[model samples]
Target: DQQVKQNSPSLSVQEGRISILNCDYTNSMFDYFLWYKKYPAEGPTFLISISSIKDKNEDGRFTVFLNKSAKHLSLHIVPSQPGDSAVYFCAARDIPGGGNKLTFGTGTQLKVEL
Candidate 1:
């Protein structure tokens, strides 16, 4: 079964506006959350992350929020630019499981329109 899911398959935002991507998980064993941005032919690159203990984490124009009780998380990009358009995947880590395997969501395609 797919433990992680991105409810929205795609999203469109205007350049210079805020872009919000959402994710939901069915597994409660996840301890860490991460967001990855992938371009056409390139591997997904780390964007921002948050620990389950904390509700929010911010880096530059990106922010990640986690709701442990709800098993939900979101990535926010402020003043989104065209360069930020890509497929974003939400991943969760089961730190207690020993191996560092990450469970990834299906991914959400974000398009920034100019």
Candidate 2:
């Protein structure tokens, strides 16, 4: 079973607009959530994260919100830029996997139209 899931495979947004990517989890025990952005061949870089203890966290134009009760999380990108076009991956770290391996979603490709 996939611990994390991105319902939308792709999303397109206008330049300078806000893009919201949603993710859901099945395991209620999951405690940590993270979001990563990738550009083509490069590896995904950590964009934002939200701890189970907190409801939300923000960094620059990126924000992550976590709802432990609902087992849902979301990443919001404000003023989406053309350069922000890339694949986004939602990840979670929990027990039973051991060694802190991140469980990831298939990925959502975001396109910023100018």
Candidate 3:
């Protein structure tokens, strides 16, 4: 069973606009959430993240929000650029389990258009 899921397989946004990617998790054990961006032929790179203690976290043009009640999270990228086009993955860490055990979503392709 996939603990995390990204309902949308792909998303397209105009350059300079906001791109929102969503994710959901079934495991209540997860406490830390992270967003990773991956380009073609490369591993995913850490983008942004949010902790269960906080509802939202922002960094520059990127922000991540977590709703514990809904077991949902989202990543928002403002003023999206062509360079931001890639597959975005949402990952959840099992705080109690420890040892860096994480569950990942399938991913959502984000395409930024000019």
Candidate 4:
């Protein structure tokens, strides 16, 4: 079974609007949660992240909310821009054998329209 899941395959939003993406995890050992944005023919770039100790974290137009009790997280983008169009992946860090590894969820494609 997949430890991380993104139920939505895609999302669309008009420019200057808000876009919301959701993610869920089944692993309680995961403490660090991150959101990455990926473009065609390119690697995913880190976006926003939140630690299990914190309920919410925000940077500029991007925000990440984590609910430890529910094992859920959500990413919110305010005033979404065209450049923001990309596949967003939710990832969690797993430290096993003293090594840190990331488990990523199936990405959610975000399209921003003018």
Candidate 5:
């Protein structure tokens, strides 16, 4: 079974609006959560992240929220722009051992319309 899941395959929003993407996880050992945005032919770029110690983290127009008790997390983008259209992936990492490894959820494609 997949430890991380993004139930929604896609979402659409008009420019200058808020876009919300949701994710869920089954692993309690995960201590770090992150959101990454990817273009069609490029690798994913890190967006926002939240640690298990915090409930929320924000950077400019992007915000990430983590609910440790529910094993859920969400990403919110305010004033979504057309350039924001891309596949968003949720990732989680446990405490490090040999290396910091991440488990990623199936991505959610977001379409921003003008």
Candidate 6:
């Protein structure tokens, strides 16, 4: 397989709470991990990324943790807001020669309720 998978198609969370999204992968050769957020009719925007050498990466209100041993990863958003409602994609790519290419998941639609 090309690798990378986000099993959830949607998620719902109340505003001001934490939203946790899960992802998994099969290929062991993937070295670069990225999470992207998208709005309807728009392209995904880079959120956070991690290398095979690290297990965690954080940016502002978002945090991503990777588990190399389990071949899994997750995204966490604190104080989830209504504005956070959108599609989230968990993506992966191999840094065969050092580049920002990627393979994306089906995506998950997160609805933040007020």
RMSD of each: 0.9, 1.2, 0.9, 1.2, 1.3, 1.7
Clashes of each: 0, 0, 0, 0, 0, 0
Worst 10 residues of 4 by lDDT: 93-102
True-structure lDDT of candidate 2: 0.90
Better of 2 and 5 by TM-score: 5
Better of 1 and 3 by lDDT: 1
The model with the greater lDDT, 3 or 5, is: 5
**Per-residue lDDT of candidate 2, residues 1-114 (tens digit):** 887999999999999999999999997767788999999889899888888889999999999989887888999999999999999999998866544788899899999999
Candidate 3 or 2, higher lDDT? 3
TM-score of each: 0.97, 0.94, 0.96, 0.95, 0.95, 0.92
What residue pairs are clashing in model 3? none
Worst 10 residues of 6 by lDDT: 94-103
What ranges in model 1 sit over 4 Å off? none
lDDT of 1 by residue, 11-46 (tens): 999999999999999889898889999999999999
Best TM-score among the predictions, by candidate number: 1
Candidates 2 and 5 compared: the better one by lDDT is 5
Check candidate 2 and list the clashing pairs: none
**Model 6, residue pairs in steric clash:** none
Where is model 5 more than 4 Å wrong at Cα? 96-99
Instruction: Indicate whether candidate 1 or candidate 4 has the larger lDDT.
Output: 1
* Backbone clashes in model 5, listed as residue pairs: none
